[model samples]
Target: MPAGRLVLRRAAMLFAALALVAVGVADGTGSAVTTKPFLPDAKFDYQIGGGYPPASGVRVVSRDVKDVPAGLGYDICYVNGFQTQPDENGADGQPLEGTSTWFAADASRKQLLLPNPTPEYPTSTENQRYSTPYYVDPGWPDEIIVDLRTRANRTTLAAIVGKQIQACADKKFDAVEVDNLDSFTRAYATLADRTSAREGTEPEEGAPTLMSKNDALAFAALLIAKAHSLGLAIAQKNTAELEGEGKAAGFDLAVVEECGATTECADYAEVWGGNWVDIEYTASGFSKACTSVKSTISVVRRDQDVTKQGSTGYVYAEC
Candidate 1:
């Protein structure tokens, strides 16, 4: 072969090889190629229960999936993916006329219920249970955890939570924020008594199952895949410990709660960079976060309940 022709042929082969490698990379990681929307470093709001006017400069909002998105900016629909919300009447209150089925059930086919322990409004009935299948968090009796440990339960969860993600897309929201990714961590703490008692024994016939971190990660990945399929990006809500796993599971951004108060803001900042938003519940937390690197990471302080502006307890501030 002519020397020039031989060199040209080799160059062509190298270019083709590189093209194949690019294709493989794109296929192997959807996050690399998918155009998921991200949070902007603009005024932000986290109003899950009540709707409010966007403060001056507001450009991003996170509201309950059932609520309408802010008309002016990127909106994130919040879904409680790992636990059942309190009945429509409110936590530990009467279940709505036809909403009891929303809660999950345990192995014995019995609906698991947790007590509501709000100090100001403790439940009148100590044994009252919510309509959920997963074990309830002892510390937060209002939330009944969902079972993410087994495939069957995860499938069921997918059906339940996947609809919410779809709803977000249907509403034209930019992203879906799935909360309680760390419920598995709380499961260990809340289920310690039952797990310790049965450590060496055969499991009881209808005992509650506690999910491991891996179980939660797998379930999150399932939800992320579903959200992406619907053309909606997903956010990793809180759970700084799982930031890496959240990224691996295909979460596009983060809606972190109290990361600055807990000193875990840096971890999430590193993972999502400008794609993350943090909310602090206290004045001191807001101050601390504003002085740290998080000041540049889109931090805000809001009332714990995230009420609306006219509500008595409503609070909102930005770094």
Candidate 2:
């Protein structure tokens, strides 16, 4: 064998490896998985409720994981990645039992679920007695947190979400947006989120679940890897604080909600550049976001519910 031939063979192998990375394949290590990233600053819309023919020139749209995508340009399938879906209950208001049984605190008591505490059930006594499985977001009671405290749990969740991503791919969506990336801040904040949320009263027993930013980031890696392997880009929803880690974990874009309202647009912009989209729900926030980054980033003002164009409160303004 000649040295020149050996060098050519090695170079070919290297180029092949790089090509593999570009097409999105994952080996579990964050380094190997990469996707063809979506272009930055496209006209965008967030329509999680239901699909509609997108507005003229809209290049990106976000929809619920279960719903059909808008099919305009780059569709993002939205999944409640770090939390239980709000609609996970039977019509009777009890947790569903079959395939979607996200766990419950029954006599068996092995499932990782807390109570949906309220004024009457502040102590989680009645809520638990009724087997109401939840440790919900303070702002959105129906949205509950999932346990990402262990490797098994994280793997389980990743598989669950991976199926949702597969559905998006099956429908030909361009991307997936795993929402509630910041759920851990509430799930683990017993001192601040638990006690304080309960009117400064003593927190109930088993009040807080063991979810942390580290768990969320680790979990994001699983989702990112799964998305990339499917040749679909993944969005880092909210949690601008985790933007740096999320980017390193192979997140392809950012789907920010109220960054202008929270004054954290810069945090996301710093890492994602203009490859991020912002949805503002308030007039003031819309003004700020449009005034600041609209020239470079994709910014839109939408109704709080992201109502369809025909809905009464529907509002869509791009800046």
Candidate 3:
């Protein structure tokens, strides 16, 4: 081809490339590769009981989202991704038998409550025994509830959580909250105990189970993707560790439990920006959390039970 013709062809190709780049920028290509924003609203409510049409004048209510509530302004979905609920008789009852492949106890001697001792906190239950099934190998199905790291687990979680997101959409909720993001840390003890037992070592008295942080991040990424696809906003339950792992985890806001009780409030505030709502279950905790983050973050207090509206021990307050 002639030099002039070649130059013209090159120019056309360059123009086409530029056009594509412009289109991507205009339509969110950079956004596709970047993290989502964390926006905490000023006025908020945290209600997970009595099926969601929470008391009057409440603007936000965190719920299971799987069952969307009627006339809810904002909905945060709850998912037990970390620990498994015990079956009849717990270990003696085969708590996780059908659902989990992971279960181990040295000598088959059953202990009521498994022990968990973290530096800042300890498992509240002195006899908290979970069905041994969820304690099985993390790789196996039914071992852990959420299994955020496994593709299979992620798929299952997404489906269920997705339903909640859809419910939020259906109910016209402003966002979706996912609980148990911090279960990885919470389950660490139980998981360690299982690992020891599998290796023929005697299981510790009350070890907690641990989830793979990498896997959890991957799972959150997928969940975020689904949420964004559905045009629904997502919440970071309580996993402060993921603050630096990249925000593609589909979080737009945060709902922290006992932030006052735990030192994690500051971490959540830093990561989620100024848009977060914290719940304090104790009077001391509520006062501290509100005093500390009230100016920058929204804070509230609810009775520990977080019971249904007319329940005996219902308590709710806001600061």
Query: What stretches of model 2 exceed 4 Å from their correct place?
Result: 1-36, 88-102, 105-110, 114-133, 198-209
TM-score of each: 0.74, 0.77, 0.63
- Give the Cα lDDT of each candidate: 0.63, 0.67, 0.51
Give the per-residue lDDT of model 1 (tens digit) for 101-186.
34533333232323222323322222234412234544445556666657877876777778788888888887898877776655
Question: What lDDT does model 3 reach?
Answer: 0.51
TM-score computed on alpha carbons, candidate 1: 0.74
User: Which lDDT tens digits does candidate 2 get at residues 182-224?
Assistant: 7766553443546454343433433554576788888888888
Specify the highest-lDDT model's number: 2
TM-score for candidate 3, residues paired by index: 0.63
- Decide which is better by lDDT, 2 or 3: 2
* Candidate 3 lDDT over residue span 106-179, tens digit each: 32212111222332232321222332323322222223344454577566555655665565666655456655
Clashes of 1: 5
